[model samples]
Target: MTEGDSPMSSIFAAMAPVPERTIADATTLDAAIRAADTPFVVRGLVLDWPLVQAGLKSAQAARDYLAAKRKDVAFTVSVGEAGSNGRLFYDDAMAMNFRVGRGKLPDIFGHIASIENQPDAPPVYLASIDMDGFFTGLADENHVDLGDRDLLKSIWIGTRTRIAAHNDFPQNLACCAVGRRRFTVFPREQFRNLYLGPIDNTPAGRAVSMVDFHDPDFQQHPRFGEALAHAQMVELEPGDAIYLPSLWWHHVEGLAPFNVLVNYWWRDTPRWLGQPQDALNHAIMSIRELPADERAYWRDMFDYYVFGDPELPRAHIPEGAQSVLGPLTADSAGRLRGFLLRQLSK
Candidate 1:
């Protein structure tokens, strides 16, 4: 049989494994999040939630449930022509392939209600609306009690749609609240094989893979075959959830005519550590085009000074004299930031 026709167990057997763990309730979910270093599926984690109950009744019931909680707040929604077949991607010339506009929460819900059952309808997505900001009580009604007050809770509502493969900076808990959803995930090390798009100007907020998952042109993106070999697929039913570690690439597909997904994102890093993307951008600007030998030398330097044991580098130096290379407190981080600003000014 062809690879496409092979059983899922056979396909997954060929690739690296993604584990599945069952957590009985929300309390256990918090522990799982803290302990899990890899991506995992949590079966029926939110099955008892009221939102899931409403969704199980009917799509209309779910819509009404959301509408009742929405406080007339406006959020951005993405619209694409029906011709695109729900894939949000780029055209031949590499322009944004869809239109994004602002609309109210209730209005978007009405739009979903009007077209949900139609056999042919344009893709409409209320992508990544902050749930706590727009629907104030929604988090309280249905939520993951991770106990992190700063955790970001967001809502995704859309018609049948496919989001291109992309990575996020924070740890993600994507809960399928209303409809079935599919996720194809790849480990962070597969970055090169994914045929990623431009870093600076992205179709979505994050840089997405240029290689379309539905109909990848193997001739143009041959490495994508390698990526596919390593992919792990999961189908999440209503109330199922998946934990995606930071930097894991994922492609998402909404299987139903209308879908509502609730996601929580947070970082364990200290606030002073800042974003690693900034350092990556600086490295690209300063080091990417350097000679091979110089690049190798810098790589070794980074391995030793940055990724190596923090104590190893500063063990011999006096605490007061260690400067930027020593333990980083808020004051030291501020000084380092000032130093970087001065360097950039030149």
Candidate 2:
């Protein structure tokens, strides 16, 4: 069949298009990150990185380059049976459907090499290994010049893998090092329509949408149609990168026999500010199941205290007496934590 007539093409034709922004160098990238409002694709930025050069030669050469830089540290790798079809997802019982095995970098690389030529090999993924800890000098060769910010760099290596749609806490920059990839992103506002699975029990590190992108069961997850209407897609080449804003829901597909991706994750939140996810968990326990009238009261309280004006609430109270209502600093946060622990205990 022709490209336009293909099933995948028909599916993609329905979703919103993701915008692409070509960044020339590190200076342009810095400007983009400073104004981080939406997701954008960066092309030609990492064309000169050594890893990209390695990938251009061959997949084996790329593997060799990474294997040469391997350190003696153990990291977790996800192993899925061939039957799973490269998608790391939940089983029928809503439990995680993959096995995690600890392996060193070289061993993982060797496993990837072994399955390189297999027609129907099982999905073996060395997912999210920290670049700084294991592949020490690798970053020096292919790193983003984010200046003084403490950015976490991680690598994802796998063969034709699919990671379910999930939102991350930090802003992300995923650079394709050795193969092509397709990223389907949706705005945070599309959360309700995305049909997210269990929050407490997740397949991967984060809660994933139950609706499968490859073959979505509309009967079971009918609301997912609305999510698709608001979706955006981007395809990345070896040297391409995509910047995802914090809390943007993204579904990732590694589209080659042997794929390697390097991602940088960072957030602009202050260290003194407590994790918003923690507050979400607390709300789930305390507020989620409350009666509508009681929840409505809490909503107004949140608007007045947490979501609304910060300085206005403490305008009357003395600075020292403001306690948890005041600005969050190391001492104030500690006291608030203790107060929360006491409340939870009760």
Candidate 3:
């Protein structure tokens, strides 16, 4: 059988080993993708058309076209490890979803879609694209040639290829053409449960999929509850996609031997009232400019908001007061923290 036709040889194949699931019902796929926590919710989501017909019905034809147009493909700028940096993949790492300006994209993998023959390489990240420039055109309807946007950023995600837990910058709609996929989602609050890989927003691909809900070792990750309570997941078939919110952690797997998918990356509204704090730059500044003790203090201070517990981590100013904390309250800590935030923003 040709690579595309042998849909069961993938690691996530029906024959492959997996944890027993308690998932019930076999109705709407979107519900499973959004609410499934245990194997308890195993079903199908039959959406995304051009993909299913083109991939499953005419596998050979699609593969032939994909192979011939390899050079025309211009994505695969490794954001992180499909293994090592799986966490980064969680947040709109899929090239297509990002409403990126031409200035931001690096075109790292180049547009040539190479039919990967290397055993070391995976096939699940096989075929995908963004077409951001294409959509932007619909709004303005200007003379958008999509010339430089010619780079086809598709992932030939090999089957059994697993991506770690993480969320995208926004909601993503993915369409599978030839194969099927599985996704597990953790809401934004579950960031701690996921043993995140890197601070660099982009992923170079990673080995570990985010949280292992199948048989979680709660003892090892005590704080994992923050993730467990908000879990959602699903298995995607040809022509199906999942909509994931920003900061939500998710693990993904290519279920079929020959998997082909197309996803759109879109952003959610900004989280902060003002521009996002340049925490990275601050981290660098602390490490470089401060003495060792000062740096450590700042590090802890940073943790108070980013990693510290939710109840009383750091402080923030109230909405409409003259006090540094915005509004004055009986709590002095909040004011002090607001002062610090102001200092940081400056």
Candidate 4:
């Protein structure tokens, strides 16, 4: 479709010079992060870091390795972005060339070194830095008291693909190297201006696609101009990193081939109390338990809760009811589970 075709999207361009480069020292990073109000630059984010160094070496070898392994491999597909389940090759668009799963070499994608040597060959793997190691480094850098930040749940994704405008789930510390990547961030409050795409397209259910930055079709989506008034953009290379708060809408893309990105993702700290179900789970509960009439009511309720409304309590919630906000311990979790279980249980 056309740029900014959707009315629910917003765009952010490089509006100012970034914060220049630094060693990403813990003390320096803590301060520099606050100054990154707008999209800014942080050079050498993770180039020398041992984690990224090895991944780049791995990506370089993928060129010849994948050629021999492609016969048995197939493109990994999500529900929507990969086409109507018929697209050729996986979504290597800009992902790092690397492997996944057990002792197997994955059909990774990266910038092809030369065509003369292997003209028909595909790009090699890139962006395969150690996920857990990256986060452990962040936890140490921030001194955030991450009780379990070293768990193996870490994930490092590459293949230079466009991650449309969407909020991240876990807290994110995206460290880059080798090549460059541009990250455009809009405030959480500006979700309205961002014409979001279909959520089912991504595994995380994020809204894919974003409003074009340079030349948006304002005629169709005139409201998107508001997003320009307040936006942030950053270009990250080796040794640079950005602290992405939980659930802040961000649009990210790889600017070059063979770029390296190592992100440290950690779940939010557990709270003392309150129900802790996420928006998606809560949504399923509303849809399944509530009748058609009630379900419609819930749609507006969530819009009011998440969008805008007076019903949202502005005052502090009493400490007693607050414990319900913790997903693992919240009574709402049990209720939500029971609500869904009734249907699945049948």
Candidate 5:
């Protein structure tokens, strides 16, 4: 992709720059990540990796390196038609514009390479494939050590494509393994202005902003301009990486014909803890349709029970009679799940 290929090129001067950190190695990287509460760029973070070296040589070399490392397993891939302009998103009727099917690494790479130089090429994306699951030793060979923390390490390979703004529950460290990428980010508070799409019926797993960053329809989504006011943009070259805190919204753009990114996503909380999104989904079903007065009452109740002072709930109740109001352990969590399931069944 060229300079004018992305909308960020035109509005680049207006957006705030994401902060940068100079991390020397994996240990320092881990420390920096633990300390970060916001997104920041890290230049040359993985410049010494052999995979980075192969990519710097050429896209073909990168492809060859991946093919040699990957296991002979078919992975799910998404392909957008030519007119979609590299956007893997929903159509006017809320149907996805892209087609998804399974393909092996080598065949997918070959197809991506075949249309690499075309001006109006279709977008082909191999997204969020678990590195260790599909590749024999690629994860160990091309990786940044983040201590012994349990992590979900995934790889994304694709041509020039636009991913709509979406937020993740886990903190992310995304490395530009090959080619180039530009990220347009918004804080979690910008949710009201982003004009998010349907949560249940989404193109990808996450709910994304409805606005098209390339050619934003201001008349339709006027508040998106406000979202841009709080937006920050960062462009990463090969071997560069960026860290994003949990719940921060990001719109990603693949700027090269054969771009690849490797990202690690992990939450700070215990794995046994319930997902917050599930609670939110249940709230929408149970609380959203209530009468205005009843809803307001529930809001206050939630504020007191869920978001209020932790100590306040147990302060008045006897220590022995606190039950679910007290501290939750793995056993308590399992009982709570069972109770909720029984209640739902009724």
Candidate 6:
């Protein structure tokens, strides 16, 4: 049998690994970013980063490096109960299992350090901390130059933890700055099989898979077994990184006692085009509850106008009169936003 087609008993063990590449310089890394269409491990891409070097020495050293970069910034940190066992998720009542508290970088780092070797340590996750916002010169000292790409650089610092499988809208390059991390990924097509949680209410900003990666209850979520068939797994050591294309679901695990991850997020589209999630939400509110036949008609309309050929309109109408049906510009996008606001206000 092909890899990732293993029997249920040895599911993770026989899953396919993400392709690996050894990148040595900025030019090669930039090219990889431009060409990436799937998830792949970029081995030792950030091996020379100061923070990674510190982490290679010891967890304490890694913490010290982060502490030194503090800029008197207060960060919102998530602290899960011991019972949660490092999974930042929702409780039985659908309330979040973790509580957020504001703290400085050093205090958060110190808290993570205190529980480094403790048994059953409560999960202390300071996730998605904006590197430029929280730390002074940290981004400059420890980052890969991605050429002209405008990136949202974020850092995740935590104890041994598991982030539920989630997909972000932007392409991601995740660097393992300290400790070890394992990523189990599934492509966008597996959305139906993943058993996603509520879009409106989420543990984090994005809707995540309800399936527990550590001990997946395949009986309850039978389709999850189907998702594993397309899964790819990779373990990243300190200084290694992985590139994941947009909207690919990934479940992340911090395998070591203390871990720090730096991730870069960017979209290929222009900033003014707006988010696709917003469009999905609007459709759900306006179109989801419509009559079946009407919904089907609207689906056909969407297929013809949005997803199908752009040149199809030119044959039926004059080019200048095409209006919103034609190519969209930043200025036109602003006007379209205004038009949407007017329609919504009614």
Which one is best on TM-score? 5
In angstroms, give how far residue 258 of model 4 lies from its true place. 1.2
lDDT of each: 0.84, 0.84, 0.44, 0.48, 0.89, 0.88
TM-score of 2: 0.93
lDDT, residue 133, model 5: 93
Question: How many clashes in each structure?
Answer: 0, 0, 58, 38, 0, 0
Superposed on all Cα atoms, the candidates' RMSDs to the truth, in angstroms, are 3.4, 2.4, 11.2, 8.6, 1.7, 3.5
User: What would the per-residue lDDT of candidate 1 be over residues 209-273, giving only the tens digit for each residue?
Assistant: 98766666889999987888879888889999899999999989898888889999988887787
Listed in order, each prediction's TM-score against the native is 0.89, 0.93, 0.48, 0.57, 0.95, 0.94
True-structure RMSD for candidate 1:
3.4
In candidate 3, stretches whose alpha carbon ends up further than 4 angstroms from where it belongs are 1-48, 68-156, 205-219, 222-226, 268-346
Backbone clashes in model 5: 0
Count of clashes in candidate 6 = 0
- Against the true structure, whose lDDT is highest? 5
Model 1 clash pairs? none
Tens digit of per-residue lDDT, candidate 5, span 223-339: 988999999999999989999999999999998888989999998887778888889899999999999999999999898889999788789999878887888788888888999
- 1-346 in candidate 4: lDDT tens per residue? 3224533234333343334555346567656544544434456555555544544565454234333423333333221232111111224453312223322223233223432133222323323334333333432332222244532223233333454567865566676644556677767778778776445444244554345443468886576767666666777754566667667777666544444555656554644222233446557655868778988887787676556643354336665565433224555656756765697677
Which pairs of residues collide in candidate 2? none
- Per-residue lDDT over 49-105 for candidate 3, one digit per residue giving the tens place of the 0 to 100 score: 433555666544445444433344344433223332122234445342112222111
Clashing pairs in 5: none
